[model samples]
Target: QEHGVSGMFTAPTAIRLLMGYGTEPAKPFDLHTLTRVFSAGEVLNPAAWEWMQKQLFHDRVPVVDHMWQTETGGPVFANPYGVSLLPIKPGGAGIPLPGIYAEIRTPEGAALPQGEKGIVVLTRPFPGLTPTIWADPAYIPHRLNGQSLNYQPPP
Candidate 1:
């Protein structure tokens, strides 16, 4: 608040800590200084999302969620902020960002239709990706070959 911070991207745990701090005994602080909060790295349960909305910001600031990992180097499923501000679904990660072609597949690799839970996979390349693992450069590619898959990360 001292620095006039307007937005932040953090894990759900951090938000929960701030929520705890705002309660009695601790000095009361207004969250209106914040305009947006982006969260990832864990499931933002519906109950927590509800608390973030009703109790945290009074439903004024948007709590956005996305899915990503160090390997992806960027978000595969995220709200396209610059393109447009889409509606928030309490516990849903927004649709795939432009240029990202992702799909869900069973443990055995068969594709599953939308709304079915499965492992997420990226079938196409995008920006900011490492081509090979650091420890074993040939391991990932060789394993893909053994599995009859040719998954290429972005250059």
Candidate 2:
């Protein structure tokens, strides 16, 4: 509240702690300065999400959850804030980022139908992903197999 931070992306644990502390000890600090809150790393429990939306911010701010990895460098699935304000799903991650060819594939490399859970794979290349995490591509065995592959954007 003191720093006037308008946005943040953090784990559910930290968000919960801050919310809990803000209400304790008689006076609640004003958190209206925060505009957007993004949660990742751990699941945002239903109870916490409800409390944050209903009790904490009074539905003024948006609490978003996205899924990504260090290899991807940014959110692969997230609510597009600037492009469009999509409906916020309580426990579901938002849609895939534009231009990303995301699919759920089985071990045999077959694409799974919607609502089925499988290994998430990128069938197309996007910027931000590094060509190699280590000195050699040999370090990534999954890249050699059909089950998984790395996306290298065309030069």
Candidate 3:
């Protein structure tokens, strides 16, 4: 029953499914062998995180919540390893990693600041990112088309 999966990157929905199937805490499982737990493809709910924090990662093992999209290319935002994790919010996308710029955008290409809900957009590209799409360097401006949503002036 031991799979070679020290790293499990899955959605909260799938984690819930595992819990539904009766996957219990791991003071029993080799927590030492398990180094990291990554959640993505959906928001990580508070209850699920609490299970990991209390039951799963009591040793403070790493957990990364990747925020990404295909439009801006690969994951423009992510929780890098090695940094200490903070108390996770119930439904918050934990703050972006260092040296990266990301913002939510609206329909008309205006940028929205932190805590605002708009189209998540990256101001600059990140490591392992393709500068342009499909071998077209000049095609980037159109590709990274901005929008206006939350960061609008009072009207």
Candidate 4:
């Protein structure tokens, strides 16, 4: 209407809020200026992506999927925009971004491989990562029985 803007970075929930307000995303809008869109916090569905693309992209609007728990403060793993995305499956957290280390482990402390989901572990501790429960920051890192998670202070 007045000031023209393009591209948006927000969560899937927020996008739904805008659509609920009766904003017609398709038909007519200066969508060409829009180049990118991102959704995180939860998951991004293909249906939602198609709707948004109609209203926002005349060409192609890359949808960057991100994943990170509050414990990580923000997205530590994300699909870089404009890159090859394996193709959006109905419900799936896209592969980790470059350099993100993810480990799937079990209560017994053995690492699980792909095609198996287990307790998630990180090889490198993110500075923003909360290492322990509240008021127990100094708790020692050890396995429940034998193998355990490893932790080390940065040099």
Q: Which is the winner by lDDT between candidate 2 and candidate 4?
A: 2
**CA lDDT, candidate 4, residue 79:** 61
Question: Which candidate has the highest lDDT of all?
Answer: 2
Looking at model 2, which ten-residue stretch has the lowest summed lDDT?
Answer: 146-155
Which RMSD values do the candidates have, in order? Answer: 7.8, 7.4, 8.5, 8.3
lDDT of 4 by residue, 16-56 (tens): 66666544555465556666777887776665665565554
Q: For model 1, what is the alpha-carbon lDDT of residue 78?
A: 79
Residue-level lDDT of model 1, residues 70-110, one tens digit each, is: 77887878777667889878778898876577899999999
Candidate with maximal TM-score: 1
Candidate 1 segments exceeding 4 Å error: 18-27, 130-155
lDDT (0 to 1) per candidate:
0.73, 0.74, 0.60, 0.61
For each of the candidates, give the backbone clash count.
0, 0, 8, 0
TM-scores for every predicted model? 0.73, 0.73, 0.60, 0.61
> Counting only residues 3 or more apart in sequence or on different chains, how many pairs clash (N, Cα, C under 3 Å) in candidate 3?
8
Model 1, CA-based lDDT: 0.73
Candidate 2 structure quality by residue, lDDT tens digits, 1-155: 89998997888887678667654542466777799888886667777777777677779899888877778888788888767879988877789886467899998899999999899898766544755544455434544344434433223
lDDT of 2 at 67: 75
**Span of 10 residues, lowest total lDDT, candidate 4:** 142-151
Backbone clash tally for model 4?
Answer: 0
